[model samples]
Target: MATDVRVHLVDDNTPFRDSTAWLLETAGFEVHAYPSGPAFLAEWPSRRRGDGAECVVSDIRMPEMSGLQLQDTLRRQGCNVPLVFVTAHGDVPLAVEAMRKGASNFLEKPFSDDALLDSIRNAVAGARARGDGAVDSEVLAKLSPRERQVLDLVVASKPNKVIADILGISIKTVELHRANMMAKLGVRSLPELMKVALGHG
Candidate 1:
């Protein structure tokens, strides 16, 4: 019902992208369509509002960057744009993982137009509740690139050893960066940390 919200749609399939954009437009929502993840990312910096009150609808599988990776990149860049992933039926696990990683929602392929609209409505509402993605972007902008990278891994709820292994850093180095990020973000505990981190995307 929120007609003013902008929906950014990205899909490798030209027909799917065009059709979905048309469907969303017909529903009284404004939409911007992109052919691929990199293409969208290239434009987002100039297009996003300072508050980032936008939602992205992307296919789960694309040529260069998957929908999941797009979500991660947004988080890393501090955009925190709400995301609704489109997935094949068999990619339900990927959808769930996207949700676990803070995607707004997911729609199965060949979904009813109503289903996608409903998901967009929910995403827009969530963005309103989250204060329009402004705080996250500002807070993350204060961190260095390395800190943001560490925070990205940290947001996955990974442990120190696991994070270090994944990033190819020593455990002590990971711990140091973790401590630095928490202090930089003014969070005193893990629960608080997760609250501030996951509260964004």
Candidate 2:
């Protein structure tokens, strides 16, 4: 769906990287495949020049300079390029850490093609909405008190039922408040909402 979008695919495994690149290219994305994080990082500055929807999809574990390190390096340099990590089941803790550090998303190994594509699209969109600015305080002010409460819980990764119980409201009411909060924040999906909640968009 995202025609001509640029995607940087980073992985140590030759086969996986090649296959993923092929898949993304077939889906109309312009992909640059790299064998390691450092390899990708070395070429990132020049590639970031043009204005286009772009994101990095990197394997979390690698022999030299792990994905987390790469993310840290980028953040330290004030680069806000959205990142979507490809991780193994055992690397979930690392993935969660990456999320806390502002990664757009993470996909476990053996993920479906559609899932990866969706994550990349969402990451790029979220980054574009953010655009080196924090979420506007005036937009956040549009939320009602109840909606704000729902938003906080949602950002904490709470489920609707749990949020309802915590707020002394019904599940339906929780959903309603959540919907209103998302609408007020101008977000259409949980990932988008999360980006907003984190004050990035």
lDDT of each: 0.78, 0.81
Give candidate 1's error at residue 118 in angstroms: 0.8
Question: What is the per-residue lDDT of model 1 for residues 154-196, given as tens digits with 9 covering 90 to 100?
Answer: 6544567656655567999988998888888999988787667
Q: Which residue pairs show collisions in model 2?
A: none
Please report how far candidate 1 places residue 43 from its true position, in Å.
0.5
Q: Residue by residue across 68-187, what tens digits does model 2's lDDT show?
A: 999999899988888889999999778767875777777889999998988887677656655644567688789988786677556645578656666677999998898888887888
Find the 10 residues in a row with the least total lDDT in model 2. 125-134
Backbone clashes, candidate 1: 0
How does model 2 fare in lDDT? Answer: 0.81
